[model samples]
Target chain A: MSPLSLTHRDTVAGPVLLVAGELDFVHAAELRRQVEGLVLHAGQCLVLDLSGVEFCDSTGITALLAARQHALAAEAEIVLAAVPAHLERILTIVGLVQVFTLRATAEDT
Target chain B: MGCARRVPADLNASPGPTTGPGLRSAPGAGDAGAPVGETWRHAPYPVLVADRRGVLTGLNEAARQYLPRAARGDRLRDLAPSWLAEAHHRLAEARSPGGGDVPAGHLGDRFFEAHPTPAGDGRVVWWLIDRTDALQAETALHSARTRSEMLSGIASTLLSTLNVPRCMEVTASLAAQHLAEGAVLIAPPQGRRHQLTYAARGTGAVQVTQQVDTRSVPGLAEALQGFPPVPARWLNPDDIPDWLIPEGFTGPVGSVIVTPLPGHGVPAGALVLLRSGTEKAFTEGEEAFARLFAARAGAALSAARLYAEQSAITATLMRELLPPKLGSVHGVEYAGNYRAATDQERIGGDFYDVHPGSDPSRETLVVLGDVAGKGLDAAVLTGKIRNTLQALLPLADDHQRVLSLLNGALLSSHQTRFATLVLASVRRGDEGVHLRLTSGGHLPPLIIRADGTVEEAPTHGTLVGALPQVRARTIETVLAPGEICLLYTDGITEARGGPLGEELFGEERLRRALAGCAGMPAEAVVEHVQMLAFQWLRSGGHDDMAVVAIGAARSGGPPTVAGAKDGMNL
Candidate 1:
């Protein structure tokens, strides 16, 4: 029952939002707001660091959609980093894992 | 209220001010005769005229049918039945001379809009238009708006729930608030009896906290005892026993809509919307809204279920990749722990495995590795490495040779692009226990002694598939009795802690944990180490960890591949 939390650190690649905690309906809007505030430049990459995330529900998925929209609106790209096993499975089942570029961490190619 | 106006037959009738002896017919009917006079009576409404003496002067065919009495010569005071005469008098006093058309009274479930226009002198023409359709349309529109608002509120409520049951309750209550009364009953039958649960509206005096068994209501049981549930609207009021109407449901009411809540396939339960007052009956529009909301509620339920199912599946899949329990060899006992990350969505590719090697009579092959990514990509890579390792065991007893084979397979195959791996095999039987190990950019295994000391097994090998000419080296060691050994993923070594990044649990913490638990049984040793790992991370051990613990079950026991079998995998 650790409070679900997410943190974003701006890297050379647009921004890297490291999310930890339950990304379910309760906190999804907060995550979306943070994503919305990101300044996406053309050709930049918005990396969603999910290494610390424990749970992600449909609302969380929608937040990711919002983040993707923010990036695409600016003609930028978005990627996922350190996606947890459970979240990855869900993303895969829903065919989202394929849509987003995934890396092990910031270091992984 | 005024003198009656006799509209001449030849004059063009006014568009709106419908008048004459033809205006007092039935409410919905319009005149169908006499060109000029017909137009006046056919002005899309019923017009009635009454003079100052309250004498009924004109009865248009259209206006004649709507009233109980349309006799031309009768006085208005006597023509209408007693009840209606009093109502008309009240209406006349309330009518404004220039108020235009407005609603007057409700009669027999119908609403009336009365428009009174003064004629020459003191006569008045009362134009009555049936407004039930317009009022009903307006009410329906309001109901739809209310339903949408309730749905939006439910969506907001769903956002805060993590526990599935609480989410379901919220969804059910949201649906209930828009249906039936301010309370709703959800009943799912189990075996011979149905378990009924109720949720009340956001604000109401009625507390919907009751369980009604099938036996308690004979009608409900009979309705349920069919292929498809008997619709509540079709149930005769006489057929329903008095006790079944719940607490507030009294006497005969409007139609009760019994819509069965569809399950995955079959009908799971019923949504009964009982209409009480005549005005409270469910319209088709309301029923459609209920169905739409029900579909959304079902989707939410399905989502919760999918989450749980995937969680269980992920745990199972992670377990499947781990080695089974191993028997004691010499004096060594073996055990291991595998955690597949905290993500509830996908199964990770981190895996550990143990099996027989080329020298079947003497050794057991043990492999541990973490796929570069997660989910299916990582899982597929793990699978490839695992299958290759298993296939190579019978072909090579040398650790470097086995590692070389894995590298070649990874480089040649399109399945697993690349991976980090550790392959180790231990000799069993009288020759003591000889450990042969190789690493492919994988975390090195740790050897713990009986004297409370720890060392990283000195073996560094090229990462598998990184290059075509990647050559790996093998390190050999002989383990004595009453000793412990640990092999794991970098998830353990990379854990961060302490103030200002001062405490790196790294190898030191792991060494201490192993040494402390060295004297315990193998499984207990694994658990103790795992507990330390969890504690060190302070956060459910970020990133999945695969731990293999090999120790002596009793004193003076040698560690062997048989022991490594249980320790190396999972």
Candidate 2:
């Protein structure tokens, strides 16, 4: 179980939050807090880069949804970039692919 | 003559004018006439007339009685030595006609205020008024305020922690810091003769628990009788109780205040505060403050004790509710695992039992069940169902009869609660191994064949405990070798999670996962499925899950038990 690491960079669209490692119960809250602390402007898009996430649990999924809700409440947009295959399968199974905008990579965003 | 007159020894007893004929009237003294002089002679307060050079010119009777040796021509500083210097300064200022009265001062133990006025001939008349009672009242009020503040501090500090031992430590340390030098808090003995004691010396607190017969401590037993605080003045070492003295304590304790900590209607413990050095016996005000603090500590201790006791009971009950370890059964590999929802206590409605057959057939009976709800209520129902099934083990050959009987028992005793269960009877013969499975509205058992094919055994029935009678069906199958049958509760298939948490890991996914476990052992099959479902839920927030796997040993030389090869994976 690799420890979760978070990094961020500013872009013209908004800020890109890069998440890596396992996103289970113990580490999900950390990501949630980090995403919630982001300052976004209306019409801006927040990109969540999950290319490095090796595993994700239900708590991690809930955290991502919470980020989407936060973005919606702020009248902004949120996108998932570089989702892994297993996680993408889960997202498709739960029918959340339509809720979040997905991109192949951060460069695409 | 310039000789000063001495005051009479019985001045208070005489109650008469103090003026004597030894003095001659000065020129222009008639301006302040004899009538005014007579008024000054009998005044209640001390009155004195002084010249510019600090010489006393006249004195009143009250002044003579208070000072005992004051007369004309005596320096005013010689009498009332503490206040005369300040009075002289005030008198000089008074001569300017706009100066205010002098501030109050003390003479011996008596407090006094002075009023100086020009006497029309360069002399100043000083009147002294006592203010002892007002000062004492202020001092008392200040002490009371300090005591109440200390009480609030101790209350907040002790009540902040719910941990029993930590609360004791805080109580002792706070008492020492605010109220006394040495503090001791003794909790009532729980079950034994030993009492929990926390003692503080200076700022450091130490726990010194000692078991002592309650009869040995005289005043302590009485203090524990739930009375108001008992104060004791210890004049000597013998005055201290033999049993109450803490080890390594060697200082002179002047007084002890012992108060009962009454909790809810009973006594929780006793708090003992010891004042050392020159501190006097516990005053009324201090005792009241101690009682207030003890009330708060008592309530907190009572609550903490109750919480500790409840936790212990819950732990014991959980241990009993947990499924027993599955023992090795001949000719079959068996493994079982149970995991409750993350938010619930470890005890849940999910339960599994393996009862070996005692009849001629040598069949082993296995039961997996899930009650309708969770928590203690559901756990109790699960226990009843398991016990009833165990009693019906003799009917293992007839699955319908056993389940039908269980349904009747549930309908008669617990009509509101319902359960879903699966019963499996496994036996060995020359042919190979035989299995008769019965499902009481439970998910059908999945059989993973040696050829890596997964099939659901044909078993269906009505849910038990819901109706007067259950129409259960028994399905029979044979495992040649290296085949496993998995029984699980709905917690596996109905687990909700994934992207939007709207997805369920239904029977399709379960069948697919089982297809991969063709030659795997029983324990491995159970572990794989359990892990997969856990990963599907992600947060592990699904309902209680219980799985039991029974696999026929693959035929080679000899068959190996499932957990024997690799220990239980549960």
Candidate 3:
């Protein structure tokens, strides 16, 4: 299954990619490709809704890093929504959590 | 003659005749010469002369009268029966200065006693007396001795055995010995029928044993079917149907006595004795003994059954209440350990649940909690709380709302019980990840980053079921890639670390550990944090713990906050 699932909802958060499966070695490239396909632009914020992901291995982690780099290159920002407790711990320990802007829900965006 | 007088001179020399020679009548000198007619009439201590060879040489008038012989000499040995002659010879040999009574001969209804006196001639004076009364007394004395000995032998045989069948066998043998011609049969009750348990005979006959139902042995049934059952006896031959009587049972079976074994419950069987026509029926005392035996047997059987049943129940209950292994969740391996208290009847109070997240897209939802007490009651409450959470998870919007709903669901019953719970939902995003944490008076979640660093996630709510007015704690954190999170029960933190209960690897210690583990993946992060928890406690944690970890990729840039510049990230 594709790690990156694109879903659009007419909510205040705008177009969202609800990543519903694990972004691991099995599907990280697919996730990276989906992020690269997004129409990035300056001033626009890409919302990555992660409520569906059950796991995020190192490979998935790298794909996520690539998504951020892509968005940065386009001068556009990225928002990580519905971050799970396990992933938050990894970020905090690595001091990378301070770099991510996380919210409880996409609506919070 | 005087009672103690010495008789004539000749009499002392020759006492009794060898063949009763002296027992002859006196012969008066017949007139002058013509052959005197032998006067053989009176024999009073008859005087006759016999030689040592038992030849009679002469006879006086009394001798002639006692023997009626005209000849002057006769051989006495040929004149009497051998037994009589032998008696006389024995008397002669026994003779001494003081004479002893001698057996002369046996007569109808009489025994003779003879005394002898020697005379000048080769003769002896023999006096005989009858001893009928003494003999009769002796016979009677011998009969009584035999009966006493038989009774003692019977008693010993009865007491020597412990086996029921052996005892029964001995009983039958004793009966045959004393009663003479009858066989002994013991029919024990077998369900609705009476089965012949034992039968024996000294006659070397194979005893026929027939099975008799209660219907066939009605008289026996009636007597035994009573409280403190008694052995019943049937004496009428007609009472037993001919077909039911064991084969080879012949003669007038004058009577059959069926004695029920006396016992607490129905007798195992009755002891039925078949008396032959030639033998007398069983007396009342024998029936009483059979009943006593049955009573003792019944007690043994009941005791054995009771012991078996009690132990079986105890073992069954233990197996049912204790679990062998914990449930495993995919992507979230779970380990549960439980120990029962020393209290025999108490059940465990720890519980846990792993369910699919309410949002199909979210990470696994895991909850582990414990009731406040230890017992069946606590266990029941634990089950209730676990079941309620499982039921609500699929529909509940967030981890916090699930706890609130559970608290509400238990408000009434919670009047007496309290529980600690931790609920966690894991999700991954492109930049990092998402987690919604809630605590219900439970231990905070342990978050382990890929760098081997650890932190206890803060819970912002009160213990579930603690109060009617309580809100759940909700915290949101986005995990950068390569970090892990753990949610556990207080069994890990409050675990005593030192003698004074002073050493505790509290939240800070756990945070440091998780920080060290931040370099590993989610699975390894969980394992390392648990290892530290165990090491801090110096053993397995003291109570139940549930750990849930979520990790994400690394990004040098800050995780994008949704509408970061627009809305406050509540």
Q: Which candidate comes out best when scored by lDDT?
A: 2
Fraction of reference contacts reproduced per prediction? 0.00, 0.00, 0.00
For model 1, the interface Cα RMSD in angstroms equals 14.6
For the second chain, the TM-scores of the candidates in order are 0.56, 0.73, 0.42
lDDT of 1 by residue, B255-361 (tens): 55544444455443444555555446666666676666555554555456557668788778756554455545434455767766655633455677667442325
After superposition, candidate 3 runs with Cα above 4 Å error: A1-109, B1-330, B340-347, B356-363, B426-435, B476-484, B497-570
Give one digit per residue, the lDDT tens place, for model 3 in B1-570.
002222324333344432223332223221112232233223343444444456555556643443464354566566533444555455455443133324344533345444444443324444443334444554556545664565555555555544445555555555444543444444444454443433334443233345555556545565445334333344466766654344444576665655454434544344455667775655654444434433443333233334455668856754554433323222223333444332354345655655643232446565666665556666677778877877886754577677778888887775525676677665545555666777665656666655565556666555566455555557777666666666654444444454444465555666666677665755565566566666666542244333445445453333233322321111
lDDT tens string, model 2, B114-198? Answer: 6554556677666665556655766788788887777777777777777888887787777666666667777787666545564
Residue A11: error of model 2 in Å?
A: 68
Q: Cα lDDT of model 3 overall?
A: 0.53
lDDT of 1 by residue, A5-99 (tens): 76767776678888888775467788888888888899998898888887664456667766877888899998888888877765643345546
DockQ of 3: 0.01
Each model's DockQ?
0.02, 0.01, 0.01
Residue B287 lDDT (model 3): 47
Candidate 2's DockQ: 0.01
User: Ten residues in a row with the worst lDDT in model 2 chain A?
Assistant: A89-98
